[model samples]
Target chain A: MATAGTADSGSTVPTGTSSIRRMAPAEMPGSSSTTQSMKKTIGHRGVETTTGETTYKKTTSSALKGAIQLGIAHTVGSLSQKAERDVLMQDFVVVESIFFPSEGSNLTPAHHYSDFRFKTYAPIAFRYFREMFGIRPDDYLYSLCNEPLIELSNPGASGSIFYVSSDDEFIIKTVQHKEAEFLQKLLPGYFMNINQNKRTLLPKFYGLYCVQAGGKNIRIVVMNNLLPRIVPMHLKYDLKGSTYKRRASLKEREKAVPTYKDLDFIQDLPEGLLLEADNFNALCKTIQRDCLLLQSFKIMDYSLLMGIHNLDQASRERERGGAASGDRVVLEGPVTPDQRRPQAQKSLYCTAMESIQGGR
Target chain B: MATAGTADSGSTVPTGTSSIRRMAPAEMPGSSSTTQSMKKTIGHRGVETTTGETTYKKTTSSALKGAIQLGIAHTVGSLSQKAERDVLMQDFVVVESIFFPSEGSNLTPAHHYSDFRFKTYAPIAFRYFREMFGIRPDDYLYSLCNEPLIELSNPGASGSIFYVSSDDEFIIKTVQHKEAEFLQKLLPGYFMNINQNKRTLLPKFYGLYCVQAGGKNIRIVVMNNLLPRIVPMHLKYDLKGSTYKRRASLKEREKAVPTYKDLDFIQDLPEGLLLEADNFNALCKTIQRDCLLLQSFKIMDYSLLMGIHNLDQASRERERGGAASGDRVVLEGPVTPDQRRPQAQKSLYCTAMESIQGGR
Candidate 1:
């Protein structure tokens, strides 16, 4: 988004320049990227990037023009509704603060979900910038927020204080409370419970605490806030409707869109999804971890079938035991044959990829 | 841990029938008070708790028998060694399991970071029990494991898991790498990173493959398999060595010998250290969840002139803004001369209570 491409270098523009490139403003001090694409019919903002070509654009006043286009009628409405003429108007302040300075990229949308759009600052990662904030996960600004509803000009960094709404009040985030809860404390405690810990069932302690925001309110939430556990629901190749057409014009592309109604859903998945060795290893770890927690929590019995590593054990203690990956153990629940598959698949378990087929 | 009088719930055994109590196994089950206490004691195995003015009874062959009766040792060296062995072995197995059996009160040594000692079985919340396993955290178990450790028992509603682990060479885990180059994928992409998480640092996602373990075999570690980023370093808490006492026996209590050396390197913490709120609402949530992790990880951010809560702006804004309870967020950074006084003692920086003299 930098203008000179070297915008941070503080390069200057020719004084009498009248091209689509930019120079820093004397008053407001803003400017960026030299758009060098061929121009056709331009929009209020800049050239609409319908095609894959870049458009050359003059930076000054461009952002302002774009904002005005969206609210031209509204601006004119506010101008006439003002009560005082002498004092600077509140309408001016609102317009100038947000609309005119359209330089922030954090506000850009990247993807669409049902009824909303998503703006990802980055692919979700370990210790995201959001964690740096003083807020709990449930109290984060975007947890349940719809992008189109909020007027956000900036994406706050991890520790940067931002406002969030919970129970209808705009509160700030300050703490994490996972380990403190009676039920949640085990999240961390279980990690140290075993040596050579192979598998554990208890979720780990992520963190705990409270967050303060919007001047003075604190919100609390348990953390290591769980992510959506996807269990692969369904998948299939989709080539239907107008999808077979190629070399379609933009108008034709828009008109002949294939919809979800055209797709099929699977009733259930097959058994023994264990494919590669890594997959088996992961399942073994999970089972071990699970058994460990079940024992600690008092819900399950130890089973040789749950061994995480057993390729060696199978050969040695062949009589006393079950399966093993290496030394890791796995729980051998009854294998639902093609006969039991119907009932079990009713539970709706599928492999990860199948579940992601067209994002079922 | 609570000082309550015992009610004979048809479970407490009479003095001479101690063997019957052992034979009965979970006769008394878990004490009820811990469930009501602020900090509930949870464990991998079951525990036997004494709630009220408890009658003391000792088991004969218990590995802990020697340590419990320091004076009755046949050979101080062998018995003490045996006791340590038994306790450690039992503890390892118990902690390694999945559920926390409602057990007798925690007989944890203050110096040891663990709170619950494995002894007998007890009750627990079942749904969370199932879900904890259903949505177990990945941070607790690493995939580089060569085998899965197996479980032996489950406490069920009664509590505690029965599992087996032997010094005999048995594979506890398993791993099968995809390739040698898979290890390269464990690190972060040029733009992505694993960053420090809870108990373990999130490994940079390299690649996935296989490794050789045992004699000739396969083992694997799925890199970047991180759960919600956790700050494990925050969970640690360091205390004076004097706090490391075993539950003082009646005779030892009478003798009143201070076994631990005084910490000349550190001093007695001020009374504020004793001000325990049921929940650390005043601290930022992330900081609190990481309270244990911080200590465990040694990621101390506090400076000499500052207190832990000072750096929390959200807490300050919360206090200045006001919401609930006595959890006031303290402000950090620069203060005016009016903020200080001549006759004052400091506590971990500028804690208000640290001032010896009250200021207007």
Candidate 2:
């Protein structure tokens, strides 16, 4: 069961700790008195509160959804109105800020949700970037706001919250203030690099928004969800090309869709991923170009998020009544029944660069 | 009883025609066969349609709401993301166009409403104009889109359509293509004049949008609704200062809130509106200044839309069980009980410029 406040509070659980050790009843924060007080508060608000964790999750989820909906609605709507143009130095520095007051009028209806301050950085630049990536304004809005986004488990130690668009086409991740600032500064170069090389493996940044609510600045970046939703991934890895502290913890490995790190990848796949000669050369060239650009911006500690869909394993599982152990592939689209073919030899590998942090 | 296709079709009913003439059964278009076919179509679409007029009105209203919602969403969103700047020469010429396809994605969900091409003119200039007018973005959006706009009976011979915002704070009118063009060209001067004098009686243009649907270009301009919804206006006039053809038709006089003309003013209130010396001087000076500005731009045929709230009449109505015949005062805000005072002799007068047509 998910713990209350663990997702957003950044409360650390010691690495490699056993489930029994982590769940010591004496260490649990919910005492009988605390529960009684919480029940009273919930009653006063006229809302059902089954548990503190559930309430916190519901509040965070609703708040995030409201902010994202309004922010995307405004951003995409604005982009549709303006002409596409070259990114200027001023564009990089300019921030468009709007406050949705609690007491709104007929034209701007008051959302019962908490008041929020939404700030968009380099809107014009982002508009152009989205256009280059073949994303339509309406499509962008519908993806982010048409339905409630699915909250994904956050595997990163930064305690960042993750949400995937209902269609699994986009991922919205809350980032630190420094990360948001760095992304804004990196925009000019990112735009140029994307323009030069359309095939680069760099993360496709769609929008950067800072939603200030409850006196906290929650910065989020919208990017393409690299993994295909329908594909059954047998294994996934976060490869940083480093050895030190690059390992998945015992607790991390217990999750259904555990993202093993560099050390795990090295131990599990000793022979490494084998690719066709042409495909290998193209992948290497794109990665090299992307790294050069990242190095120029002094960005480091980025990892390639790789998902491997094992054809043979998937075929075997399909043969055994379509149930695969430890597989968490989302059944969004139609499954390829052809995966059952024994002649299928290659595993589908998908890789996307994740979390490009600025190096000191 | 609104006739089917009359509101949007621009079909003319001869001036001064009586209700008997309008209701001539032989001239009515809804034959049994036509009604039967319409019912069939409505049934095929699986939507409730009681009458041809209702269906048309609903379609137009929904199309309008969708376009306005998306357009305002885009415009206000864009405005919030941009900085306040001077109205450039190019700002007068730039048109931001966006297409909302029938097949929309998650980000831009498809509405069952018709596909629309929304074009916004001089967005930056309009943004600044809206700011100068003290209209907040959220308030603007909420007023226009939070609820279906109340469609007002179009009194103009030009066959223009008018919709009042739910909050009675905005008037959205469909303008002719030429009028839309004239307004765009007039924006720079309008911006300057508004900046020079904030209290000008000139029409406050909030947004200019052209929504293209069903191969018809419907241009609409959003302006401040000068008439207060809650105030009971006993008499109203549209005075263009021209005696020629400047009389309210018999049909117009039968309406609840009839907009009388110059001839009617001369015939009824021969003494003219009695005002205190100070108030009279200020009104004249403002009108004189506004007229000079309009004349400089070669604009003509603009009329003063004046509404008179009779305090004594309202008091008398309150005394007689609170029902006033022919009074269309919207019961929006709380009624000021002080209006019941028989000693309240002074009448309240409100005046705003209407239909600013450009001279050839």
What TM value does model 2 have? Answer: 0.40
Per-residue lDDT tens digits of candidate 2, residues B108-227?
Answer: 447777787788888877776776566766767777877778766442433345677876667776665666777776665565455434445666678889887877777777876656
Identify the leading candidate in terms of TM-score.
2
lDDT of 2 by residue, A77-160 (tens): 766777643344346667888787767643244777788888898887787677666676777788798878876644233434
- Error in Å for residue A301 of model 1: 17
Clashes of each: 156, 19
Model 1 regions more than 4 Å off: A1-140, A143-233, A236-271, A291-360, B1-360
Docking level of model 2: incorrect
Each model's Cα RMSD: 28.6, 26.3
Instruction: Give the 10-residue window scoring lowest on summed lDDT in candidate 1 chain B.
Output: B227-236
lDDT string, candidate 1, A99-201, tens digits: 2212323432222111111111111210122232223333332332421121111211111112222221222222212212322323222323322232222
